[model samples]
Target: MMGHGPVGVEALPRRVSVPAAPGSCADSLLERDRFEWRLGDPGDPATLIEQFLSTHDLPVTDLARPGDPRRHGDGPCGAALFVSAAAGAVLVDAPPGAPSPAAGVPDVAVIVYGHGPRHHPSAPPGPDGWWRGPWQPSWTAQQHAAAVDAARTAIARGDIYQVNVVGHAAAPYRGDPLPVLARLGGLPGARYGGTLAGAGWAIGCASPETLVELVDGRLVTRPIKGTRPATPAGRAELLASTKERAEHIMIVDLERNDLARVARTGSVRVDDLYAVRRWCDLWQAESTVSASPADGLGLADLLRAVCPGGSVTGAPKLSALRHIAALEPVGRGAAMGALGWVGPGRLDLGLTIRTAAADGDRLHVWAGGGITWGSDPAAEVAEARAKAAPLRTLLR
Candidate 1:
């Protein structure tokens, strides 16, 4: 699928100077050889974003607060925050979170561009970086299967329709993570890809889902659910699977409702449903939901309507969140939140799946799948493992 000029994953055109007024969305640190990032609160995130869109007539980009709101102090998630004007230009005040030399993963949210030696960035994970310590799974296969069973039990009782179950693994590491980010950001069909860092943390993402996008006065979102390994047989199976299709439709409907919350009346619709798209080695089922803003809607309002993304959280969002909180061992952190760019009359952000975080000596990676009535416990466990395989291979 194509878009208006170079937007979303296309990012900025290289060598473009930072605008004198710096209003162009794509003209920023991301397209450069190097840039700086750090942590500092931008007042209330919601309010700051609103001003960028309303008062200043500028754009503000950022990672949304994760589903588990309790992890707020981990460091301000200004990972992708870029403002159009100079006053807001210096988004973070702390020291820059440049990549360390050890070659680890990226964890905390840091902006890209500024105050670093310039060089042509490597196109992939330069041979040096990989997890060198023991890795521990937050939930082993048996444990994850138990969680899936619990979700299925709830479904039988009509307590929920579908839910996403997730697990994480951590390993010790050190040094810079930019090389890993470079490799991940180059993944095939990665629409929302980039890297950001902080004092001891950095986040690298190669996501395919657009949680929300507003451009040319229109709002858009691409929700992805079904997944299958990239193979002739696997692809065919994904297209014919009844359970995957049903779960996908339910989430698509949920996304339409979410977009409608902030959309102009009578302006919401599903532009694509059950669309098959390739993300790295997997073939995913995706759908697009779009609408125009309702009178008096703003960034804060749009975020409240949809933040964690339906495909990751599940349908009947609140219920699924409760289950996820009780079932998963740790919060989602910077992964599965949101990332991308923001510009004048344009806003684009994607779910941070296929994401990894590096904090000091620890590297974290997470993966999971949607569970429905037809979902098999064994299959669900396998799915999560399958999703994490690529990252594990790279880090190993």
Candidate 2:
């Protein structure tokens, strides 16, 4: 592991690697060199991202053909992007060379890890680990439950079918958050887990849901909804609940529509439906949807189509977004966005759920679930805590 300097001071040297645990998805992408740029265009990050990648000779995958093996974790990452829920994105090139910063602080940093023998200087002792401080929630359980009821009311009024009510929690930390981040990213069932850091802010991701991925000319997304504890009874309850199934189906339909916009005619299909998956100690329902890309589709076009994923939003994505803006206490920040590697003719990005950010002074975390008319307000509050507990536990 490399030592971290004072936040926002020194630039990260070229390559970065996270030592992968046994059977871990957080593999190493030994980058040759890197360059960092911050795109302020929140409304149109796709265009900026596409342009940046093109200018830097990194790009969208168009050459992938049918039957090409999935290369998500095996190859050198061309670039990695961190898109924030606030409508902005950060791009990092993954070729070779020292990091060349653009201008302001980056929202999230990019680090690619690879295998083989290597050594790095250890971080200083004082700023090395996190303190077990009292974490604070942006919304109390009552407040979060009230938001859930509000969503249910909206559903009753026919304003929206379902809305994801998010809650935020934060705590001050005295040390570098890298170790906590690494441990969070290495947790079991983290299909999309890793640490990406910038000057002032950093994200430790342990997302199990796939926001979007493209390989062999096919675009794929796995929207996860409906959660329960990860136990025999929890799995049974999750699979049996009609309400959970309904929530899962709604997001599946929404995802299908999102992909249909850029899919080849009549090529979209649901590969799986409501499969229960384990993420640490939780059981969540996930469904797979895929489509062949339309001819000449680009990365910018794809992101514009399915970004701010429906599972995190709600049915009728735009309206749900409007409600979310009005109800949430704080901005979603790095959570509920997209994070992962982007390579030419191949891309793999995960939905930033179960993700946390550290901004020099404080560490931030967000968690929530889809709210439907049948949702129980109290249960919803507990669900959010259940989702956040793992990350919080790892932080200590």
Model 1 regions more than 4 Å off: 1-45, 48-79, 82-131
By lDDT, the best candidate is 2
Model 2, residue 24: distance off in Å is: 13
lDDT of every model, 2 decimals: 0.61, 0.71
Minimum summed lDDT over a 10-residue window in model 1 is located at 84-93
> Compared with the true structure, what per-residue lDDT tens digits does model 1 show for residues 48-83?
455533332233332221122122232221224422
Would you list the clashing residue pairs of candidate 2?
Answer: 17-113, 28-113, 29-113, 32-96, 33-95, 33-96, 33-97, 60-345, 61-345, 109-197
State residue 171's C-alpha deviation in candidate 1, in Å. Answer: 1.1
